[model samples]
Target: MWLPPSPGQIPFQQGIEAVSERFIGAPFIDNALGEGPGSHDPDPTFRLDAFDCTTFIETVWAMSLAPEPKEHWTDHLQKIRYLNGEIAFTQRLHFISLDWMPYHEKRGAIVDVTRDPGLPLAESLTTIDRKAWYSKMHPAKLREFESRFPADKPIPAFMHYLTFQELLDNPQGLNRLRQELQKGVLLANFIRPNWDTIKYIGTRIDVSHQGFLILKGDRIILRHASAVRGRVGDEDFVEYMKAYKEHATLKGIQLVRFKSL
Candidate 1:
């Protein structure tokens, strides 16, 4: 069973809705921009090139639940779980969402897997033993590695940790992987992206009914007072999005507001 998020905790469920909206309106996906390295599975079945952070986390979650029995894992099943295949989490009941809201509660536990004292925070959350978990990169030392990437590099450098063979063969490996990702997200959010980042302060506007007002820094962005219901022209949606972007810039966050949720 799952527990509800406390009042002090950020509404990650709401945030997920907001993210979905942004995805619908975005000009281009992060994958198209070469956000991260493509998957390296030789099956010719697991080729995926897109947002590495989300993809990696999602895969870790899927692996945790094990969609099918180990002995029954066929080529078809592997393709379904692999990157090149349809990567929608909802399609598989095993898919897990590792956002802060679900795992940050008091009962939630995180297992830290790092040698350095500060890359990611997993040690303090869960009671699980650290030595039992397996990881190539320590959560505390990720910053040092990321620092090596220059500004000129369009693609972010991602450390290769797990291979298809290891993930499939090793028992209980996926759960460990999921915990590691949760730690990474916590550390990244804690140290780097605060509420100031435009991507974080998302907006939802209604076109047909009523919209909300969003304040980015000091600028006021108007969400369409009316919610968009049906048959709205794409051009009109584009215009509304433009207004939201303008408002975001005025507020001091250079963000592209596109989704409705």
Candidate 2:
């Protein structure tokens, strides 16, 4: 069973530790892709027995905020997953950099600390064309989903993201990234560069993955649900970044830190 720190525990690093301890050997399940989008109702659905990367982090964050997390997990999940705590499918925070992070930051659930380390970062905008990629649903299902929105609802044009190449080019930014890693912040990996048109169209987000940062003795570790490893696991943060750098398609990373309201 999943367990996490009581509400009084510190957020971020402490919350991460609690989640890490509780789910050390949990299996990675692609539950999000399998179960997340097809539903017609606005209710929040979650599976604790298994998790994908996003669900794992979301669950831990919700649990960390409550004295008895299991008792209130759904309520917290609803708040974190949807805008204004509404249960509508369209209200869900789907895009990591564009939707999820920005929503939470605005609500005081977290802070975008990507530029806080004084990194010389460059920004760029990307469009999430849901129709081009997310239109895979059967026409009937697509119609059902779209019916929830007003006919005049305008699609979002773009969102800002920091480039990994910029960090690679700037020694100062690299150093700052390392410094932030040492402090144990939440990180999201942007895999836009590697995603082909078909792949990008399906997901409609620049950020492909996310995880928590931790310091164990002198080593920095990324504690997350590893799709590659097929389970929840921890790895050296720098080594993971090295692997990401080697991938031709991975663009780079963005950082965020949890802050209590």
Candidate 3:
């Protein structure tokens, strides 16, 4: 759920560069349930790739099923899974967003430089809808979401929003860029919510902006830039790669090269 800065806000790119340089070396701890690596009594609910907003929420829901840990809620989940055919003990790593999720909201602004070839960067952000743009690009995963609930719903596991200035200021929106990071969560490796690795840094931070997460041992960095038809070239890419190295230096974190999406 990360995207590049809109065509506008190009001036904020320096800030983006600064932020990415801040969290290269900070430890990446998982906020998901289960035990951390190298523990003697590993967590039973741990899954390899069960990261993302929806699966993160579902895992929490599943954990809240019982106080004593019997197979109480498995049947309830199975009923839901039969319709979607996706619930399983080991299949947690393969969860994807359902189709029925809502798409857009009227709040926030937008910038559309991709559609209009001649549109200037500054003009794009002047009149844009944040939800509208993402709605068109990534429609709701409706089948995965449900609305028939009680009086209320809790906040999502991770809520990210990034303005054009924020995106321009921090391309890799790592949490360590802020001065004081305050969040109501913990990174743990057991079912009891024992360990938590949530922290924040820098000035402006939101999930909607282009950011990367290194939970557990895996790192998934999301970037949405204009399709590099001709503007960006090999040299620019090399500079970007070098920027990663420099950012790692600032944060004192070492990052191994992973496959790009």
On TM-score, the leading prediction is 2
- The segments of candidate 2 whose C-alpha lies over 4 angstroms from its true place after superposition are 1-14, 33-44, 151-175, 181-184, 191-194, 199-204
TM-scores, all models, native as reference: 0.20, 0.77, 0.21
The TM-score of predicted model 3 comes to 0.21
Q: Could you tally the backbone clashes for each prediction?
A: 21, 2, 39
**Candidate 1: which stretches are off by over 4 Å?**
1-49, 65-190, 193-195, 198-261
Mind giving the per-residue lDDT tens digits that candidate 1 earns over 1-261? 223222223222343223222222222112221112342211232212222222322322323233333422223333334333333321121211122212222223333223222222211111211111111213342343245322312211111122222323356433443343332221111111111322321211111111222333333333221223221111232234344433422211111111110
Predicted model with the maximum lDDT = 2
Prediction 1 global C-alpha lDDT: 0.25
Better of 1 and 2 by TM-score: 2
lDDT over C-alpha atoms for residue 70 of model 1: 45
Better of 1 and 3 by TM-score: 3
Name the runs in model 3 displaced over 4 angstroms.
Answer: 1-57, 79-261
